[model samples]
Target chain A: MYFENFASLVDMGGHGIYVWPTYALGLLVILYNIVSPMMARKKIVTQIRRQAKAANNRKKPASSDTGRKVNSHEQFSANGQQQASTTESSRTVNEGE
Target chain B: MNWTFFHKLGSPKWFYEISGKWLPWLAILAALMMATGLTWGLLFTPPDYLQGNSYRIIFLHVPTAFLASAIYVSMAIAGAVTLIWRIKLADMALKCMAPIGTSFCFLALLTGAIWGKPTWGTWWVWDARLTSMLILLFLYFGVIALRGAIRSATTQARACAILTLVGVVNIPIIKFSVQWWNTLHQGSTLKLTEKPSMAPEMLWPLLISIAAFYLFFTVVLIIRLRTEILDRERRTKWVRNAVEAGARS
Candidate 1:
């Protein structure tokens, strides 16, 4: 609104180079702040589920995958929550909140 | 007054649940405020006569610099709580706040440097304010590094807390550095005791932007804290129930 046109807005009377980059960097930092935590949460949630599943499997004496086999089996099932659909869980799996 | 509030705050489960309820609202408010303030400051407000268009960088620089110092002061308080009361939450807060604080501090320094090139005709100087701010950044790094050095969790918490409190001494020096010695940096634009030097149009957006940054920080902090609670309390019944139920849903 202050500037006469798009070119003037971008040019900003010759200070646009300095002004724009600072804001771009600010936006990058803000995006990082919001994103990194979500990524960490996903990693931790998946890890906890995998560990819980492995513990449950061990409690079953009749289970074929025992001792060394269980560890390898768990390693195979990285998407360990197979029964839980990915899309739904990804949306709602943040600690039932 | 009852101290039940304090005890409740100390409980991670209570904190996790309460924070979850507040997160969405805080996030929405932060988003709305940020959009309004930034757009107004960027387009509608008149440019400064002396500084021209470059003065717009103040919208980004000032809020982050404010957050940088405020977060450090907060960490020091959290450290003190950890030391005196031995509260686990306090220590966890100390741990979590470091990265966020560091990011904002880094942004402040970077933006300051960029603003400086045009304003001061140099990238940096050995001036008191700049040097003290640089020290604050290192202090943040020191707290984070000290955590990784110790193997024992308790020891790690205590060491980081002590480091944070010790580094708090830099805060006052940073505040007074402008007055204490001649510095290239100008005086504060806004002050609590006195009226702001800026015009109403510019000042309004800057104030809103500052509020937006604080809210945004809170939203991110709660998100990190909740995940931390889940990680630390994985063995507990509440966390297990929540995670399993969440997965089922």
Candidate 2:
């Protein structure tokens, strides 16, 4: 070790305040770079899943009149949810592109 | 030059598949190098004759400063390729690099200020080197903002490419700033044409740190680029299959 002991290493000969904070900030930036993209990846995956589900729903329609009404209502709500989430994801993905 | 490789470079799907294999290797190498370099720089290297322990900041500062300028030049080159060839993948690279470059620029500024506090007796000065670096940060912000503001991809790419090329002028200015004018910031210690002024013990760890930082940048950029490819090509069959496979896993 360059220093004699732990305390002195942390003290860094009275330059600890400046040196430590710089390293801390550097760590923060590095962590942020890793994290922000991972979050973006999650957002994109969610969007793709939502779209695939919607496409599957469209391909198979309900048969009975009662079933159609219930299915229509559920589909309406799902579409609303997908629209809200798609807008959010598209904004992030657009910034990334 | 085989045109097949040049043409293949334009394919986002091919790049995505290839980069996925490279990612883990790059990440492991980057992490190992950075861990070794930081440990050596912070714990093993001897103190400077004048700056004492505070000089340790150079390990982080120099690498980030090098990245900040290097990434800009790369972004500009990507921009040039995009403008000339109209390659979507190149534009994606150009766009994705902006935020990473911005973060590094911010790091350079922050670390420079921190190092200055003890060494220069002040946090900041409106000197040539400092001001030009700040401008580099703004250039990154402008590219990112312009990308967000423009809706059409082609227009956004064209405009950003023009801006990126124009901003290339500042890089040479930043490189020569300390020499051209009187400045508080010191001149370059490491040079391409000659040996570094620093001792081998200090220089070796610094060289390792610089290499590690570049590898780290590649890892992050590739990750971001992969995400860009997926998002842009979301409607394609391969993307759907990939997403379904991901869902299954």
Candidate 3:
């Protein structure tokens, strides 16, 4: 705004070479800071989901073997709740004991 | 003193939930302030009498330098909390701060070098202030490397904390290097106890930029800390539920 025209603003009174690159680099650094963590977050969520899915898959067959074929869906839900509780207890025990 | 707040911070899940609520506001404020400051500093602010328009780099240089040192001090404080309280959240914070701090340190060095070419007529120098700052960057690397080398989380946290505390001794050296010894790098323009040498137009945008950088650091730190919390607590029920819900959505 201080400059009279667009050319002067870009020229920065002949210091544009130094000034512009510095600002450009600064912008790059700021963008990196924002983008890096979001990428990491995406990777972490995907990993956690995969692990959760695998754990559910591993428990599904065991629950089916113990319950009747007709009630497999209900048995699976009950087994999931039971598995979650057991894992919670085991985690506490591992931490405390 | 009400110590409940301090105790609550010890819980990673609580911190994660609270930081999630705060992140959007902080990120928005940072973006707005930075955009305002950059526009004002780059175009509206007048040129320096001695250095001319190239002095505009100060807007980026000063904020990055401030963040470089400030982030290290914070990492040290978080390190102390981890050491004393054995708070996993504090360790998580300390771990997350390193890479962010390192990037800021790199920026400060890079900007200073670029500014130096126009002002001091050289891109690099081995003077006291510059050397101390370079050492600070190395110290950041040391902490990060130490963490990576150790496989045990408990051991890694303890070692990184000690290294951070040790590296903090360099901070005061960096602060005093310009005054204590001859250096091409200039002394502080903005001071806490006295008036800054800069004019109001230049100073105002610099102040805004500093605030914006701090807010940006906080937003990023919180985001990193949340990811760390989820990673460390993945085996817990809350994390399992959260991840499952996230996947469903």
Per-residue CA lDDT of model 1 for B1-249, tens digit only, reads: 886677667888888888888888899999999888888898888999898888888888898999999999999999998877767778778888889999999999999998888878887898999999999999999999988777665677779999999999999998889888999998787887999999998999999999999998888888888887776666556766778777311
What tens-digit string does per-residue lDDT give for candidate 3 at B113-218? 9889978999999999999999999999999999888866777888999999999999999999989999888888988899999999899999998998898898
lDDT accuracy of residue B61 in candidate 3: 88
lDDT of 2 by residue, B1-249 (tens): 796788677788888888888888899999999988888998899999999989999999999999999999999999998887767788889988899999999999999999998999999999999999999999999999988878666788889999999999999999999999999999999988997899999999999999999999999999888887777766567877888889311
Model 1 lDDT, full chain set: 0.82
Q: How close is candidate 2 to the true structure, as a TM-score?
A: 0.89
Stretches of model 1 off by over 4 angstroms after superposition: A62-97, B247-249
Local distance difference test, candidate 2? 0.84
The TM-score between candidate 1 and the true structure equals: 0.88
Q: What is the DockQ for all candidates, taken in turn? A: 0.25, 0.29, 0.31
The order by descending TM-score is 3, 2, 1
Best to worst by lDDT, what's the order? Answer: 2, 3, 1
Tell me, by lDDT, which candidate is best: 2
Compute the interface RMSD for each candidate structure.
9.7, 7.3, 5.8
DockQ of candidate 2 against the true complex? 0.29
